[model samples]
Target chain A: MPREDVMATETQLYTPSTAAARRTSGLRLSRRRVIHTSLTYALLLFGSVLLMVPFFWMLSTSLKTLAEVQTWPIVWIPSNAVWENYPAVFQKTPFARYIMNSLVIAIGGIIGTLIGSSLAGFGFARLRFPGRNVLFFLNLTTLMLPAWVVIVPHFMMFSAVGWLDTYLPFIVPAFFGNAFYIFLFRQWFMGVPGELEDAARIDGCSTFRIFAQIFMPLAKPVIATVAIFAFFYYWNDLLYPLVYLQSQMKFPVSLGLRMFQTANAGVVDMPKMMAASMMALLPCVVIFFFAQRLFVQGVVMTGVEK
Target chain B: MALRIRMPKTKMARREAMEGYLFILPWILGFLIFRLGPMLYSLFLSFTDYAARGAPQFIGLENYTYMFTKDPRFLDSLRSTLAFVVGYLPLNLALGLAIALLMNQRVRGITGFRAIYYLPAVTSGVAVAILWQFVFHKQWGILNAILSVFGAQPIGWLVDPKWVMVAFVIMSIWGVGGSMIIYLAGLQSIPTELYESASIDGANGVRKFWHITLPMLTPTIFFVLITGLIAAFQIFESAYIMTGGGPNYATYFFGLNIYFTAFQSLRFAYASTLAWMLFAIIAALTIFVFTTSRRWVFYAGAREDA
Candidate 1:
């Protein structure tokens, strides 16, 4: 049965070696390829549209009037787009303050992660210490440790230090290095040629000097990857901010948006809520588009290379 | 000359070790103070009756006992979270792989399609939740509008307990683009020679995909599955923002329960217990996956131990 099936397929795919028959078969094969490619494109387009519906709805709702948002037919396009909703979001809540808070936290996180992760990663990758391998292994294990386990104690610890309601919790630990980013940096640093470090040492460079000047400069891609991850983590984080920060003014955009939604629940101010969401979403989306390559590299590195 | 060289070599090695220690000092300090200290403290807290007021009175195993035997929300939260994991995981993996396969085709403007798909993954989780909340609105949602176009009645997505989990799953799948990118990377890394050889053996497209592509993609699938499982278990921000743990606690995820217990109820010790339970569940499942992975995950050119 298998032989017969194979023979049938073979006959169907190709005719016996006459030049004219071969030419017709070749045409048929090309046509088949064309159909296959077209089908792939069609499927992708359909998936893309389905995937993008939420985003499209967000944008569409943000531009619509409140009346348009609640209309029966679900207006795909508002006849009179409410461009004022974007600016009005700032007026409605402390949206500007939220954005500012988010930026500060994000920047602090990026700076801290870069410094801490790079230094620690460089140490693990390049230097020999007594318990280096054990320490590195511990770091990787912490990657699997759930954040929930540490959160309550962290809250207590911070409150004890009078650091609650501040950005200290978010920013301080970042300066100490994250397990995943440190791992990423270590992996990248390990790949750097030993010759460079040797040359730097021979030139009378201190270890710190070699790291600051040579390794750090050469790790731009990994640095970009780490920085982007840190930025997004701080910017988008809700649970941490929710647990730690108490003051409304100190809230990041994430917490602020949640507060906004909670405050306006049942009222359903769809346009203004969507406008605020769009604003909150803007920076990360813009950064992603600009650093698309680095993002993909970082994601793939975490998944495939790990 | 030999004595002098040996002395300097020893001195250099010592210096290198000292430098390594210095570079990684921040990480060690952070790990001890932030991670280790908090983890141990939380464990202690889990056995106490701390409420963020005054002193934590030790009340060993009461929290754990209460969770298992008495606490009304505990089982509900666990069941809801597991239901979400069950509903969300397979669909996410399948859809992510499907999109990745489609995006793997050598079609023109493929990167554009990829970027469009991935746009949502980078957005703030809070913002995405808010937008989705609007999209799932019963009376005026675009989703119901689309359904209406097909002569279907409006379904109360977020409002109805029966359909809430489905809504959450659909929202989660919208961001499947992140996994799709990883799968695409895995797909590209596959050696085309496998496909070429399969074709030479008269293997059709479906056979080639099953025999060659699926086996080769197992490692990536394993990676996605593990990470996705971890992330899914920690489903908080979306549920918190979108449903506030529900119309009637239908979306009361474990993370939300932990948060409410810790903050709202001010049962810091009990929250710690809940947190540890979550950690235990995650760890067990992770180990389960790791052990099972040996049978399925394939690595090209990998050593036996690896």
Candidate 2:
């Protein structure tokens, strides 16, 4: 009933008890458990193969030389690994600069989203005000407005304000709490017991202090989740960079990779593009490995199925 | 007794109001400047035939009329996009759900299984497109090589217009991790007692799942369906990056068409109208789902709001 979202911070849902319950059930293993487990394992394996097949080929293709890649009787593994492809990506395009730009945008976006959403969420969940629901819904409606419709206007507004061709247009708006993030944090805040706040108030905490101390401390899991989601968002996003930025130095990995693909068009060095893709995928995977539990928790809490 | 209007001190209420706004100031400002301004401007842009060079001359209804009456390409694209959405949305969601259900049962190295299924999602859409492009490149690709082992013929992937959309669909299936993860979360939240009770009453695995899991998880499935439908309808990146809406425009999606009209062609007015059409279709579908969700979308742990 609450915090349903998409293109979002689903990782904000990890509360300890529910996630723990999922991991450590009180029941003992039995015949039914064994049978069910085996059946599920078969299903999981089948699905995993389906999901992994494309990726497997991608990696294998990346190791093959151009001639090898386009040869008859395509080889899954190259007789000779084309390790040079990775280096070629850097030599061929502004990939390093793109990576740097992505890192900056993602970090800026994440920090801005987390701090701004937390503050706004605290206001909505813990503080009372008129027109809150109406205003919140208004914010949510904007989510339905296709991003394309807003592009020209955003471009005009940014150019008018002289923030074009920089990360300012991409990153600045995120400092305002996004609708979904605020909704997510609001839901979590509502569930925090009121007594903790009362006690904090008695001990002379300001509303802001209570937020930073009481709510935020209880929000580490969520904060971590938002950090990961926001990181992935700005890092991989393509359209915004394509529209707002023109300089090669300003390209994120998404748009930069596009340039690589375009430049290599028709004479595509498959290995090079695949290598760049793998490189782009690395940070997100690494973060997911560490934050998988929190990520699942965020999904559960937000109920962000769609 | 007279009903006394309990008037609170104006200062406290005023301060609370100010603080609420202050807390939400970041979001409000962004919504107005970043979101609202663009949204309104785009609506206005949709009507005029603004040739990119000068002031938008009022060409009321012309763009919309052209799309319906004269533009055969628009109709072709609409059919292609809608068919693509219809085909992909159901297929991917089903695959994702089935996998999630399987993974819900306790299995060895479940987390690793999760990571594997989720691999493509981490790689991002562009990477998926690049990888898949080479995999299905017909004569020179690994896919046909694998098929040849089973004595199957080579199939043109990106080049052939007929199989182009299918290629996109097949490629899209690789990233089921996003929805699958949500389904897993939905599974985690099912009060185990429901399953226990069902089994105790002689429900087998299938029955227990049907009676318990399916009902309990309907809300999530519904959410996924609506969002998936919306997302599928607007799929742009893979088609854009992989096919360039090409091979006779077999996969030129409406979203891409709109983008081309607005950005590439700089037909801002025509692009605006196209965007409006997109907005209308998506909005209509969202409302339809919301209204019909009453028949399904069960909430566990609490009653649905009246």
Candidate 3:
């Protein structure tokens, strides 16, 4: 979510003429310049190694034997790789079901956020209304109020409707448009030239049809951005599930992973724990790698563009 | 531009207003039911002793009074959260800016470096807790192993009460990539001409940064500081999963305290008080930041050119 600011700056930094000029300027690098550049790379490489160690350790330990994991001097490599630890995570708990639960919530959240926020964004951006400004202000106010503020009442309200321990609480809210996403969509929609909507209207298209056929089709970038953020949010969310869900069968991978850690607190089964952590983290890393550009765009839309 | 034929202005305006409302209906419903309704209900619940099973028993300002005067846990939670904020926020800002400045250098393969740094932000929450537990394990952990190589005794990172917050702060700083990204964006926006002119005036790298870079990046820093503090104050999942707010509640952050109070103790009203207190703190802090921003946050215009 934070990378988009870099994109905003990058656009300014890397315009064709400016980039060309900078490239030409780089060609005249002196011995001092070369030394400075090497120093910069060295510092960055060192920092990157420090940052990457935990991840490297996670992968390394996941393949280690339980005995190897606890060795003094911290065995950098396992004498015997425990490839079975990955499957053991599933064997020790309902890890597969937990993964399924996480997918359901994350996907559900993405769909709801896309539909709800886009429509609301289209409304706030294009459609003229008497109370539009007021409504949008109200929407922005949600950003100031922490989610925990309403959590108690939300739990009670959901419980009253017999929705506790179900995915309804997590999924339903997404269907109603998140404030930040709505703002993102509104900003994106606002940037779409008014001429397109006007041309569509001239062809006798209704407002909803104009939004669905014209604006929605052109909003793929924003939609993808919202989807990635929503997926990230629901996938890592532990507090909501902790409060509202009680049954093991209903738990998402996040809650399930935490429970796994707590259940095995007395045992030093580091390899299996690392394996479970890896399993839980895999989807997000995959999504991030694939849609890296969209992720950066999302951050830009929310941060610098604001 | 569409259908510019002489339709009555009033009819057209009314139709557009209606269309806007229709498009935004989902958000309005969501706001009223999910956000506003829950907020007001939570406010009401804050004044009553409402267990999950029964009706709310109104008890005036007792909840507020009890939190202020009698609750040692509340104060402890507040103090711990503040300690976390104090430790985490400044380091996050400084490191974020430093890494950003480093990353902002015209270095090759910088994107690859960014992707590596951003790995932690995406793979946070439960996975992070599990990984950090292994890293900070009292004995035979990788961190302790490294400390031993330096001829230093291994510190009990997550065990000893004095050091748990420091451990959490370290974990928090590990994901500074988001803020760093934002800073890169801010740095990018400082017109290159400004730097060229500064260099012309005999400014070195440090002088250019102090004069040109710092002022221009103030807006981004302000944003990061506000959001970072807000996020730190709500630190819960890691504390809950890692130390379980333990070592005699030294790591008991306000969010976890509210969670335990509501879920474990089933004291809904008291929890609501805690939640409101959190909201108040965040809101006050945010407002304070915004108000104070005028003094230091350098907007592009509406002032004298520097």
Best by lDDT: 1
TM-scores, all candidates, are 0.94, 0.89, 0.92
Better of 1 and 2 by DockQ: 1
* Candidates in descending lDDT order: 1, 3, 2
State the DockQ of every prediction: 0.52, 0.48, 0.51
Candidate 2 local lDDT, B1-306, one digit each (tens): 233433346886766667877898888888878787777787888788785777877778888889899997788678888878877888877888888877776667989998888767666756666777777777777677877999987888889888887888777777778788888888887788887788668888788878888888898888678768777777888888888788887887888888788778888778778877888888898889889988887766566678
Question: Model 3 in CAPRI terms: which quality?
Answer: medium
* Cα lDDT, all candidates: 0.89, 0.79, 0.86
**CAPRI class assigned to model 2:** acceptable
Q: Which candidate is the best by DockQ?
A: 1
What's the C-alpha lDDT at position B207 in model 2?
A: 88
lDDT of 3 at B260: 89
Residue-pair clash count for candidate 2: 5
Task: Supply candidate 1's per-residue lDDT for A115.
Answer: 95
Instruction: Extract clashing residue pairs from model 2.
Output: A11-A298, A13-A297, A13-A298, A14-A297, A14-A298
Cα lDDT tens digits for candidate 3, A1-306 = 246346545755658676555445546546578898899999999989988888888999999988887767789988878899999999999999999999999988889888999999999999888767878988987877777888888888898899999999998888889999999999999999989988988999999899899989999899888888899999999999998899999899999998898888843778899999998899899998898778777766665654
RMSD, candidate 3, Å:
7.3
The candidates, ranked best first by DockQ, are 1, 3, 2
Chain B TM-score of candidate 3 stands at 0.94
**Candidate with better DockQ, 1 vs 3:** 1
DockQ of 1: 0.52
| Per-residue lDDT of model 3, residues B72-158, tens digit only | 999889989999999999999999999999889889998898888777877787998889988888786777787898898989998
